[model samples]
Target: MFNIVKKMPKALWIVVLAHGVTDLSAGALLVALPFLKAKFALSYAEVSAIALMQNFTSSVSQPLFGYFSDRSPRPWLMPVGCLLSGVAMVASLLAPHYYLTLLFTAITGLGMAAFHPEAAKTANRLSGKAKGKGVSLFAVGGNGGFAIGSLLLATLLYSNVSTGVLFYILPYALLGIPLIQMTRNLPRPEVKQVGSLKTLRASINWPLLSLLGMVLSRSTVAAGISTFVPLYYVSYLHGSEMYASSLLTVYLATSALGTLFGGAMSDRFGSKRVMLYSILPISILLYLFPIVGDVGAFVVLSCASILLSATFTSSLVLAQKMMPNNVGMASGLTIGLSVGLGAMGVLALGKVADIWGMPVIFTILACLPVVGFVLTLFVEEPEEETVSLVVQVSK
Candidate 1:
């Protein structure tokens, strides 16, 4: 462990912590959703509306940030975004009414959108020969943040409708100011970073579009799991809020662990193969969600979460490699819009949950990974020479 840490660039760990800091907002949102639902007597659609607005902003704003990242360094966005997201999350929950919650949540998401592109671009460049491992480490930081936030909020509730619980995360936001400051003086990579519109032109090809679809698919599956699982815990399983949130922590934590290894595996085998292996086999696990009891279901779902998340690092790395001149743009698209598109699925699934049930929601979600698997077949892996070229440019 010490050797691994020693071998990696300091920038990777800094971003890992930064990634963790911003994502606490997401984890807190997931845990808070059911409570907010019960307090507001929220319909499934309304619950999803909050999620939609949050994810919508989070995803939609990435390209703008990515554009800036590619065009020039904006280290300041990291702290600003993290601070905005954390404060907004606090204000969103403490607001006097529901519409205010939606507004604040959207702002909070924009903070996330602001943070990811620059952070991801930095991680990729600093990753040296271990792009997979570097990206995976960065990915896991967000995952760990979500997991820890879930656990903290679930356990720290002072009351059933506790607004004060949201304050616990504020210190993290405060620390983020200095955390992101660490990146300011770091050396910029020597790559030929492109402008925003040119990024779109560069990515305007069949393979890139198809790969983007895979990015969307991967993100949606992740979104569905995070958005709905807590609702299922509270609604279908007759579980306590703590129980429901704990399950989400388990799911996210398992996914974080999987993220730890995903990059190394991608470097060894290939991104497409890792994508194929991760996304395809999880359907059976999800298919069994209803047949088992709560414990059994958690066990199955945890494993499924690991498999579903394993592709994240590999896919992001692949997109960056493919669009070497506009890595920030690719990172933004992959991290932001793709995630936004996927999280939007929760709105549809929420509508479905209103009509059918949670079990049906999972049943429907089971097929999405297969779709992702098929899309991977159309995306050609980057050749060795291509990767080396990008590395040389960055160096």
Candidate 2:
């Protein structure tokens, strides 16, 4: 494992760590939410408002940033976005009024929107032939951040200085300088005008719909599990909050490992193949997830987690290639837009759980991955756009 990492470029390493820092802040916010709620005496609806604003802003802005980055190649968006994410989160936490906190959350989301598309574009360019590997390493950073962010925030809670959360900004602030210096020397986009809406629509064909469906389905299952698995642990398995949360941690940690493993495998085996295999088994595992005995359920759910996570890099890399000319747009749509849309899909499933109960919901969630698997059957391997782009650059 150490040797494999040693072979990766220094730039990718920096990007990965930067990604981790950015996502860590997002996770810490969730962890801090209960504390904030208690301190401010905020209602559940009020607490939810902050999340809504952040996600909504992030959803709307990501593709906009992608479109702009594609047209203009503003590499500075990368570092600027990073700085904004950290600063805005710190600001949001410290803001006196509830409305002010809401405003800061939106701004922090804007920073995330700025971060993903541009940074993903940079990672795509830097990836060379190992695009899957590069993006997987990048994906793991977000997973690691989410996993650790809670722990970090909990540790700091003892300090009784919620204001001290400001310190987390240092990683991105310091790293952003070098990232700016390094990416400035990287490849430039070909100087063609970005197509108008009509042409862009024409450029997007059937495969995009297929990919979107797959992304939506995958996101639905992920959101459902993240939201409900802990509930299952407590309500069904008769476990403590600590044990329930640890189950989530286990899923996330395994997924982080799976992301890198999947990426390396995809590079060797083809992204489409890896995705097909990763998702097809998911439906079966998910079906077993809620039906088994306690120990059996845990085993099944863990398998599902690992399989789904394994496809993270492959999916993103595939999306970028499928729309080679509009990679920034592709990256934004795939990572940010899909994720946002997918989160919404989970909301719909929440309604289902209300109507039909969790067993029914889990079964539905299990079946959703089949949509992704079937979509994979029709979607072709992308034209070797990465290779062709390199050739064009050398000329």
TM-score of each: 0.85, 0.92
Q: Per-residue CA lDDT of candidate 1, range 268-379, in tens? A: 8888898888888877777787677778978987888777777888889888878776788889998888877887777788899999878888888788888888888899
lDDT by residue (1-395, candidate 2, tens digit) is 44335567787777877787777667877776887798689999899888878887887789889887866678788778888888888788788888998999999889988988878877877777778878888888878877777777677665777566766666777888887887787656553435235434644877777776787778778888888888766875677888777677777777877788888888888888888989989899888876676677667767888888877788888877776656778788877888888877777877776888766778888788988988877777766865366335433
Backbone clash numbers for all candidates listed: 1, 0
Per-residue lDDT, model 2, residue 273, is: 88
How does each model score on lDDT? 0.79, 0.77
Question: lDDT winner among the candidates?
Answer: 1
User: What are the root-mean-square deviations of the candidates from the true structure over C-alphas?
Assistant: 3.6, 2.7
Give the Cα-based TM-score of candidate 1 against the true structure: 0.85
After best superposition, candidate 2 residue 76: deviation in angstroms?
0.6
Candidate 2, after superposition: displacement of residue 127 in Å?
1.4
